[model samples]
Target chain A: MHPLDEALQMQQQDPGLYTAATHPGYANAVGPFGGITAAQLLQAALLHPQRLGEPISQTVHFAAPVNEGEFVINAQPVRTNRSTQHWLIQASQDGHMVAMATAVFAKRRDTWSGVDATFPHNLPDPQSVAPMQWQKRPEFTNRYDLRYFDGVIPHELSGQERPHGQSSLWVRDEPPRPLDFAALASICDVFFPRIMIRRQRWVMIGTITLTSYFHADSALLTQVGSDYVLGVARAQVYRDGYFDQSAEVWSAKGDLLATTHQMVYFKD
Target chain B: MHPLDEALQMQQQDPGLYTAATHPGYANAVGPFGGITAAQLLQAALLHPQRLGEPISQTVHFAAPVNEGEFVINAQPVRTNRSTQHWLIQASQDGHMVAMATAVFAKRRDTWSGVDATFPHNLPDPQSVAPMQWQKRPEFTNRYDLRYFDGVIPHELSGQERPHGQSSLWVRDEPPRPLDFAALASICDVFFPRIMIRRQRWVMIGTITLTSYFHADSALLTQVGSDYVLGVARAQVYRDGYFDQSAEVWSAKGDLLATTHQMVYFKD
Candidate 1:
């Protein structure tokens, strides 16, 4: 199996309870990559026996860093309507809280369609852009292929130009696995901290909370396959040691797949 | 006392539980206004004894319609750090879940500040714009004074122009109440459903999940006491019985106060 798949492996001990171990390949400085953790939490619901349908919206809050070891997940479907469902999930290690999340899933139906937000246009294709090559990066960075159009990490920039904290890039898994909701959720957090772009330097930063809204369904994901998805992210405000990052993920065919927003805690 | 205040009144039943009733003044088609319900969910945390700081991000998922009676809210601060806290809340009537939410709060500190979002400019002041008056609207509509610069409800429009589902307006309490986190949160949902602007007609639409990120502190709220806040909202995509609405609420002083995003279910 691929490393990403191994990283997300879960063993159901009983209903609403599962045990999983952290993969060193996906480990961050403190624990596993937030995206994978988020994906793992999401998987709890997706793998639930009573789950209603595909996830429409999900919010994950990181209370503390996860310790490198086996963690337990308690995911419960609090309510199930005829057409929608609500869930709550938590990750804990040694009986201590690490992260919690809430998710909404719904059965989709045919309806009138429209698109109001403008898609990023006139960008170079993924094949034309060179993938980022970095040394001394987090282990998780090596699990994905990232080709940037702008907003490269501050350490890689060698100039006096100050960016406005915006990045547009094409991203996908390193081994090229098929696209799924879990993969999409993980991809949403691929942007480097916006502070790195604005201040032209790195700082102590961690995502306190992240939310992603899914716009595509199973059919759409199947069409996306193993292709790269374009991701665009920008910071809106950095005040009082907290900043907000908003991002949009688009398929290679120019379809909006998901939109995500996150708030990060930073030390200047 | 104001109806909104009365609607938000919570009686502590225990450490992590409270009881509140739906207010007729803020009634929607079946239940109370979504904004008021969201505010009430947030108040459960703000009123909690263990809450550490102001809310930085919150997500509310509507599992079912809340009935017009007293409902129970179970809010618990699952984890608390030195400067941050995580919360989980559930609102139910007669032991059935109606809504659930999660929130992140942080005690802030001074840091490097920057704003990358552009506030809407060249707009008429609140004093110059006429307030909207409607006779057959939901009761919640009367609780606020709304002056639309554009993107008025389709029922009020009398032209052949097609809108891209966007609205820019000034909004405040009907009797002018002091600004706070709850009021700001309620205002985040003040924009009418984007479907009304996109299809140029009213449809059966309801928000399924709403997430709001607060950027203002108590000091900023105090500075804009009882003043109108500019609210701008737009739809990104409406497809397969669901659409996403993104909004930014700004102080009259051109400061971005909060940004909210929601996914709504609609029938065309």
Candidate 2:
């Protein structure tokens, strides 16, 4: 199994009880990459027998740092309607909750389709851009291949302050695995916090809450395969020690896959 | 008390348990207005004795239609950290769960602050713009004082079809009450579904999931008083009968107060 697959793997102890071991390959500064945990939480729901459909929207709240070890996850399908299902999932270690999430799933049907946001233009192809190399960064950073089209990389700060927080990049799995919902969820967090890019310095930052809306289905994701996807992220406001970031994930063929928003806690 | 206040008012039945009555003043096509329900869910969390600081992010899932009558809300502070708190709130009518929500609160400290989005300019003052009058629309329409700056209002659609889903308007409580978290949460849903505006047709539409990030504190809200706030909303994509809408609420002085996103279910 791929390291990511192994990292997100869970053993079903009971119908609603799951046990997952933390993997070092996806480790962040404090714990496992939040994106992996998010995917695990969604995985629990997807594996449930009563799961209704594909995920339409999901919100994950990081209550406490997830320490390395075996953790328990409990997912409950709170409500299942004719066309939709609501789920509440939580992960805990030693009886203390570390993360919680809420997800909504629905069986989609064909209808009028349109895209309002314009596809970004004039960007170097993924093949032309060289992948960033950072040996001492978080272990999680090593799991993805990131090629920046704009914004400064963390260690190479120019000391030139920026007036805005924005970054555009091409990203994909390091091992080039086929794209899926779990991988897409993890990619949503691939962009380093926008503050790091704008201030030209690395600071202590953590995502407090994240919400993502899926715009594509399995067929689209399968078509994306192992190719790099364009990612664009920017911060709308930074105030009272918390900043909100909004991001978009687009396919190489110009398909909008997902859009995510989160509020992050930062310290100077 | 204004009708809005009455519509959102909840009676404490016990610790973590509250009862709220549905009022016709906020009635939708099939149930109470979703905005009112969102406000009530936040109210339950705010009233919790174990609650922490201000709300930073909230996501509410409308699993089932909230029937008109009395409903019970159970709010639980699932995890409480030193600086942040996570909450799970659910509403049930009889024995069926109608809605579920998750919220994150934190004790904020002063930090570097900046607004990336510009305050919308070149719009007429709220007073100069006439309120939209729709006698046959959902009863909830009367609860807000909306002055359109662009886009065709339902029932008065122009023959011209819009290629994009976008709406800009000024909104205030019908009775002009000072803003608070609950009131602000409700105002985020004031914009009609973007699909209706883009297609220039009133189709069956409902919000499946809504998430909002609060950018303002109570002190700022108080300073703004009862003045109208500008609201700009647009759809990113409409596919498979579902479209995602994103919006921003800005004060008269151009401060971004909150940003909201929602996925809606639409029929042709």
Candidate 3:
């Protein structure tokens, strides 16, 4: 069966509710790079996007180790405001809250103003895309659809491009997952700092706490859209063996649809 | 009076750990940059340069607030090994531990192998030499030598700059004061993220938590030195009027001296 088909089967078994997903790569040890990377848990619960493309945001708090087992995730839309919707998500195992997140979502509409910019100009020309650590072993995990927006591979191994200043990329459910607006909240983790840091090696996960803000006016891509928005992120704190990354993404038209932040393990 | 001379006199007047000279900008609030900047704290704590000069690799948590006032910062080198050194620094206000930092210092050494070439070119070109932040803010807190290694001009009105990526700048006592390690620890706040974010606009203020790490083999510079090492900082989270920042500084030789991570009220 097609991998996308498998995703559909899983969702059919248990729609996009408080579901459980396994850890990916080095994230398995430190508990999903600080428990429930924005990608793994945000879509767990949502009010079901009112429209095909609604804006969303999310946050997660790590309660404990999720270890190698099937944990539970609960996501619910907390408040739907005129401009945005708020969500609260929790990941648990054995009936205990393993991790929790609070997020915001906005409706997608047509408007424009403020910052006008495209992806950073000085970046490596997209002609040099290559497979990276996490993306390299696509056979390992079925949960990730980590693709670059303009075919911009954030790999340091190729020995060419480095995370100069800021970056952006596209990410989606590996088809058939029926991801909702809430999932878009967590899906914010696609092209980020930590992943690009070890562009050459493995995706060094160091995200601990994640908070995301979304704009409802942004159009949603019902069918894993290829349009990627750009955002600015930085590794704010790198202490001991961990580091934190934060960013705000603007739609292709520069509407601040969502802002995402996280803590990732940084051990070389 | 020569800035250095005035600072020396102040040190004599109130001989306490973590004492820094006054700047016009810092004068209005507390030390400098309203409260204090990490650059001043680290620069004042330059007496033991060999111990404090390594670049900060990461910050664990920046727990409390160190406001502007006359106080003492007491720091002790916690653990120093060939690879890392740990320290315990405390900011006491009226005899209470108002701020505390547990830092880990790392040594950025050179070997025939590994990936130094990756980060070198990306390290902000210090020579593109824009007038130091202090230079632009001639009317503001003009008491330090704040060179934005990767500078930002926070809205132009305040002569503050917010670099896109990690902020790297050379900070030193302008009215150069005679400071030790403990005193320098308290001063890290001056260049912190919350303060940096204020450059964007006003938000609500919330409680912030911060942590720091010191590596082994660090060479502290708690005294007046020739060339300065740069302090690198970034913000991890900023939302709900609350945000956290992570940062560290390296000596001119690239030794990881101290690192800091803090969360503070994002008062709008």
Candidate 4:
């Protein structure tokens, strides 16, 4: 199994109870990368027997630092409607909660479809853009092939003031894995905190909460294959040591695949 | 007290257990307004003794239709850090969950603060604009003083094929209450569904998941007082009978008060 798959793999200890081992490959400054934990929480819902369909929306709260070891995830289908299902998933280590999330899934049907927001234009091909050099950064950064299109890359920010906290880039799984909902969830957090980009300073920061809206279906994700997807993220406001970042993930053909928003807590 | 306040008012029967009455003025087509429910859920957290600071982020899942009448709310402080707290709140009728929500609160500290996203430019003042006619809409609409700057008002779609799902308006509480977190939470859902604006068809639509990030603190909110705040909402994509809407609430002075995103289930 791919390392990410292995990290996300869960054993069904009992119905609605699963256990997962933390993988060191995706380690951040703290515990495991938040992205992987998010994907794992969503995975629990996806693996549920009562799951209705694909995930429509998910919000994950990083309540505490997850320790590196075996963790238990309990996913409960809180409510199941004819067309949609709501799930509550929590990750606990040593009998203490570390993360909690809620997911909404629905069996989508054909309907009037359109993209209102235009895909960002004029981006260099992923092949032409060079991958970010990661030597002393978080181990998780090595798991993704990232090509920056604009904005200050992490660790490269000098005390420069940027007009806005915006970053556009092309990113995909480093080992070139096929695109899927789990991978998409991970990609949403790939954008380094907007504060790090804007102030050109790498401060202690963590995402307090994240919400992702999946706009692509399985077919669309499959069609994209292992190609890179363009991502654009910008901060609306940075105040009181917290900022809100909004992002969009688009297919190579400019199809909007997902949009995510999060609030980050930073120590200045 | 205003009907909204009455509707949201909860009596603490016991620690973490509260009882609330549903006010008819906030009724939607089927149940109490989702916004009101969201506010009440947050209110529960606010009233919690262990609650810290203000709400930084909140996501509420409408699991089932909330029937009118008395309801019970249970709020729990899931995790509390030195500066931040995580809460899980649920609303039930007769012991069955109707809505579930997670909220993050933090004692904000002064830091480098700025608004990256400019307040939308060239908008008419709220006074110059006329309030939307709500004679035949949801009873909740009557609670807001709304002035549309663009997009087709709900129920007034004239079958025009607009390029995108976008709406810009100035809104305030109907009784002209001072801005607060709960009131701001309610205002976040004031915009009609983007599909209704883009296709000019009033389809059966409901918000399944809604997440709001508060950018302004109580001081800023109080400073804005009862003045109208500009709201802009747009959809990135609408497909498979579901669409996602992103919106921003900005003070007339251009301070971004809140940003919200939601996934809505709709019938074409």
List TM-score per model, in order. Answer: 0.97, 0.97, 0.46, 0.98
Docking outcome class, model 2: high
Task: Estimate, for each residue in A33-79, the C-alpha lDDT of model 3 and write its tens digit.
Answer: 33234445544443344312243334454435667656666555544
Off by over 4 Å in 4: B154-156
Local error of candidate 2 at A204, Å? 1.2
How would the candidate models be sorted by DockQ, starting from the highest? Answer: 4, 2, 1, 3
| lDDT values for all models | 0.88, 0.87, 0.43, 0.88
Per-residue C-alpha lDDT of model 4 across residues A37-131, encoded as one tens digit per residue? 88999988888887888998889999999988899999999999999999999989998999999999999999888889888767788899878
Error of model 2, residue B257, in angstroms? 0.6
* Candidate topping DockQ: 4
User: Which pairs clash (backbone N, Cα, C closer than 3 Å) in model 1?
Assistant: none
Candidate 4, residues B161-265: lDDT per residue as tens digits? 789989899999888998889999888888888997888777789999999999888999999999999999999899898999989999999889999999999
Better of 1 and 3 by lDDT: 1
